[model samples]
Target: MKMAGIETLSWEPLFVMRLDVAYDRAHPVGGENRRGIFPVVGGTFEGPKMRGRVLDGGADWVSWRGDGTMLIDVRTALETDDGALISMQYTGLSTPTSPEAAARFARREPSPYEDLYLHTTPRFETAHAKYEWLNRVIAVSNGMRTDDGPMYHVFAIT
Candidate 1:
């Protein structure tokens, strides 16, 4: 068997999104796991090439896995300052660095980003000609939980 050699990946800064979200108690889905739906009430994103406000109707459906990792599924809408609308979605994982960190997160304590391994791959869609480039790029993000909700530093793979 042979494997092809690939070039190293590079990233280009896209935006920083900070969300304001609301969470309700999760319900058990099965053995040692639970599910929760969180509403993304509001947020804003800014970067060198674009700026936008996150629409209020978006949501994040989270799965609390038995192994203590949080599986994230998020869908959201964004309105550029110029009125163009974009749809964004991502699936990611948030795993605690240790059992104690997981416990702190479960208690809604202030667990720093250093205490968790959080990463996401985001996809973008839009019909607006001005930003059509987004439709073809691959993107990833590094994320952290905040008191207000979560913050992400999004980048496009090059």
Candidate 2:
């Protein structure tokens, strides 16, 4: 029995992996919060649809909100096994359950995703004809913070 005007959404697994990022010490970027840029050193990702390693030089620009939220702008690139370059960016908030959990995250401890809400709508860009589908799809990623960085389970809406 399907409801009228309502369609059930299904998730297609796009990729999953941990992202490695080098945390740059927080600096004063002014105005009411401390700003920091974490250089995305390198990492790996793999799944049924894609498998790739993170390139060097991309970065995550983060702003510390006075609240428990960490506002983030993440820009990174992935080179697939077949040599297609995919550009990805996601902006989201990471909110900790308590000040202690927030401190753990700041200290680069093993703060699990259960201790915070880390969600993002990831947009992809690609030019290869075979992989052009990525540019037309809507995807979201739920991420967990580890000792090294964040791991995301990427899903495409189908």
Instruction: Judging by TM-score against the true structure, name the best candidate.
Output: 2
lDDT of 2 by residue, 44-132 (tens): 88999789898987878878787758887889999998999999998887888877887887677887778778888889999988789
lDDT of 1 by residue, 60-141 (tens): 8888876888998999999999999999999999999988888878776766788789899999999999999999989999
TM-score to true structure, per model:
0.88, 0.89
Alpha carbon deviation, residue 125, candidate 1 (Å): 0.4
Worst 10 residues of 2 by lDDT: 24-33
Local lDDT at 59 for model 2: 78
User: Which stretches of candidate 1 lie above 4 Å from their native place?
Assistant: 1-5, 24-33
